[model samples]
Target: MPLYLLRISSEQTSFRIPSLLSIAQVFDFPIRFVSSDLFRGVLVVELQREDDVEKILERDILVLSATELFAEGASYDELHTELRNNMALFDPYIHTTFRITMESCNHRIPETRQRETINTFRYTGLQGEVSMKAPQVEFVIVEDYEWEVANTPEARYARDGNFVRVYFGRRIGIGRARSLILSHSVKTRTYYGNTSMDAQMGFLMAGQALPAPGKIMYDPFVGTGSMLYAVAHWGAYVFGSDIDGRQIRGKMKGKNTRPGVYRSAAQYGVEDRFIDCLTYDVTRGPIRRGGWVDAIVTDPPYGVRAGAKRLGRKEGKKPLREDPYLMDDGEYSHQKPDYLPPSRPYELANLTLDLILLARWLLVPKGRLVFFLPTVNEDYDEIDIPIVEGMKELKFGAGSVQDFGKWGRRLITMEKTALDDGLPPTFEDHDELELTKASGKLPGHYGFNKRYAAGFPPRKDGNRSESATPPNTTLEKREEGME
Candidate 1:
């Protein structure tokens, strides 16, 4: 099987890789590895077989790639025509589709100084135009045989005929940029989390799970409704709940008022009536009218500052005496003043508990739950839930605490145990060391040995202890110390 590399935006790289792994797991394909550097703006996925490519390029899947490149002093139009002509020579079945687009670079090379040793030609075609600003797939052409110093060293370059370097691949799409723009657009006061979800991750998570249109899909902690929005756009009837009424109401209203908000759904030929949003506290009680959901896809609060905030003690201390939204006095501070008490302490554990409880109550028999959890706290125990029968963990994001605090998020997939099965396996008196040996750090915690091991060794410098010579010698030293 011929392999194809599926590229995604780097902004979405963390989630994207896991999403790809999840997709690979679902399709039973062996995912080699995920590479973010193969392309400048997108994460690259190398599929083991060409057949697996369709899983990602399905109608609901939003394809993203770069589209064009300019030779400093070359004729843009002539280069475009030449590239299109070259593409026409290749058999469609053998070659992947290439599109030409244009973009103006902030850097300029004057024509008078243009190098004649290498002929410069521009490439363009299905990839969108460059001037449009953000195109997913870019194209470049080289008509020179000599390779002058590569103009854009950061961009991938290849030598062709007289023009030795042609470069093109996948880039981030404008749809996401537009999403951000409209989210902050002045027409609405809707609050959209400025952070970008790994686009590749979103696509993989969505692509792997078979679309169940008309069947209800749930997101317990649907922050900004990103996951639900993606699923709904794919043809599922999405139902989402969050403790924050403002987010639920705000997103619902935004979707209803904003034109073309569901354009992806339209593009996928899905009906417009496939989404519903509401507010419910997962920890407090059963989700209203809760039952079996076809799938539960969500990016839950990852327990960092970026996670959802809880009312402070001062804010939740006093019950709402009246409607805060309607209060004539402008003393209200919280977004939903009427709902919040005077003061309360914000805790990430409490929020996690709420979401887990909600998942237990609402997930359909054998339903799938995809979530992103933070693993920064080594002391916290692995989440143990009775209903969850199996889980697949994926390590993602940069390892730094600050980076993880900002963008680090790991993915975990759980499936509800079937009724036919007896009680799920239970363990007693298990320690961290035993668990680490069993699961080898569970994907994301790659540095488990360093973090968890007791007195393993000094990591910074390879200095041996004066008394500790070797493992056997150390045992004798311990005995001598006992004497």
Candidate 2:
């Protein structure tokens, strides 16, 4: 195994380690630990080969770069001594055109100091031509400055002794898949709603699902096909089924009449992998039970932003109204092909439970199920995730919260261990987030707690900020033909 250094982005610190580990877990790559405190902007690991490092870089959204470690020490004097002690490490790049790239965390190293540092490492006895642009081999020196220091400080205050640790390595690869974050950004997309998944978060969610070439993926609560595009870019043939048809169909129609999801697929150059997004409620979903789909990734709508809805009545014993849904000839009006059905609020806990069962029935053995669940951050450090037979939830953390106010959502990933051989077990619903563990009275997640009622403040127009799932004017206009 070759020892490697990974320069991780400081953003989403909790997700960085898990993101890399998920890629390794998916690809069966062995990542042995070589450092103790690994998550602080720098990671040192022992990988099988350069190929394994590249495999991680292809899908990991948090890791910035991967390098082959040569030598490292706390100080520049100690670094040079370590380099000379193992001078054979520099033998391969001695006669080749090479360049040394200096990088520092917590403080910006001036170009003058950068040149001085590069010159200091010249004692490696490398009599090679210096090529900055197209180097045959590139070595990187990273300085891990004191984290307590003020971020974005003046370079004059950037002292050499301020650095806690330093590393010297040969640059092997960078996180090229990070480009997908910007390429599929919401701002750059053709059809995205207010609640559509963020590009970075979309990639993060998709990575957890372990999407790969020839993998069959699906998103049941696919809004505007955001999750679909993210998986499709990774060579997975992704299909999205939404309860609302309007999301699949373009809201805008005039000259270029392509639909939203499909149009975005073409624009993203992923049309080949973009399996059509059909309209259907997940509760009455048409998908057959089988070990077919490789992965299932989606952001199930919470109460706010995107109101979770399913086909049926708003509230009542019977699903239909008192008025007979039939024609003069006694034919069911809903049987008329163009008829649209009414929808009701699909609660959080129930939706989470249904998704687990659906994944158990639909996914192949070891196939992943990745989705989001909102929880009250103020209540506890961790929410009790859904526990079920044959559906194993992988532990990442309590929840990656980033200024989510009082409550926030976390991405939950589980794998279908085996086909359902027994009946679904139920438990007492003491907590709102506890899903399948339900037996007695079920008030549901958001209905009772009302944690999100004060989430998004009301707008001047009286309607809350959640305008994503608005009143359907088309449905309101169809009073005589309403479902």
Candidate 3:
């Protein structure tokens, strides 16, 4: 039997197992699929027999990491029970002792070598601790490799003796684009209206969730087409559109554009012919009707960046200004002014509502709309769009900043329903909608949340103490050492 690895998000282990089981049933695989945590929140499922691994791709398949698996539609208790049941069925052998072998190359180490060394070390150390008490012994070894040696005199003159080490630890999602380009030598650029990984993760998670071949995926807010590259790598018919004419023309024309997107595409074996890049505004234009879309996954702007200008105001102008009000007396009262078109947040909210409503018009009823919705003051209750019913929200434990240290964002999945007869009334007024006040101070009222949920602590304040344990800390530390 061929070995098949099923990767899922960290906290989503509960849903990942069931999804694996479902895949097993769909593929008609016999017996049980062995599952193990590759790292914290990352579950790897090895099919009991991989005889028909290719067949699973024929259906709409998703390989979720443990973190994103159960965040939606399931409770922790339910997932725990399922996990225990699955473990009982598998009769897995619990490995308590961890052997950590640190091997180093004598020559100047490549980036890949350094990464492998640190990852292996962390994995052996942390995973061992999880399975048993403490990883019994850590072994370190150093070896000289060909890449480390300089053959020419000039090369020898510039050579700095360095050892490349290898190890393993918890693996987290580095946005779909980063993960896809991890093994490649090409440069990568992410196109996003909201420059945050939260937007990228939704696309990444959706890419992991959806089946390849015959499935069509699109991102309406493909500011730079970052998400487009991720889904396209999985052999799906990827389509991307942005309201910005310049971005589309730049990408299409290939003039003075960053070579990363094209280079990465070539490296991934996806040529320009495979991707469909277009320019269109979801709020104003139609999304080429008559074709069925399997998934509409995107991160609409939070009215912070690109969407701010579209909020009907000139750039750099405040939506609300404070004006002095003179009464009969000499005393002046400060009056809060209103927006010319309205604040970008309100305008973007309306645009988002329009997109959701329009997505329903375009999507095959029951199609999934997965997106990263910005929270106002950390409050979600303020969203009062009747068009978006059956809303499922997943709080990514860690914010995007924990991984990239930028913005904090959340994941929301809403399914298009056919029974729209009894929907609630839509609120046209922005002021009428109830806004929820976040308990803690958020970075920006409208910027992308750099802190993703995967690395978030159970308590908001707990994150402060556990700040050093970020998923990419090892990588960052190693990079610094190399520099």
**lDDT: which candidate is best?**
2
lDDT tens readout by residue for model 2, 108-209: 777888897888886788888999999999999999875665545554364654788889989998888878778888898877788788888888888888
Measured over all alpha carbons after superposition, the RMSD of each candidate to the real structure, in angstroms, is: 13.2, 9.7, 17.3
- Stretches > 4 Å off in candidate 1: 5-11, 21-55, 58-212, 251-275, 288-291, 301-343, 375-407, 417-483
Instruction: Give the best candidate by TM-score.
Output: 2
Off by over 4 Å in 3: 1-48, 51-203, 208-211, 251-267, 272-275, 288-291, 303-346, 376-407, 419-483
Tens digits of per-residue lDDT for model 3, 28-74? 57533443323322233444433443333322123431111211112
lDDT of each: 0.41, 0.73, 0.40
- Could you give candidate 1's per-residue lDDT for residues 221-307 as a string of tens digits? 665555655566556787666666655444444446532223333433443644655555444424444446666777665433344
CA displacement after TM-score superposition, residue 297 of candidate 1 (Å):
3.0
How many clashes would you count in candidate 2?
Answer: 1
TM-score of 3: 0.46
Runs off by more than 4 Å, candidate 2: 149-160, 316-318, 321-339, 380-383, 397-403, 419-449, 455-483
Cα lDDT for residue 147, candidate 3: 48
lDDT of 3 at 467: 18
Model 3 lDDT, residue 277, Cα = 63
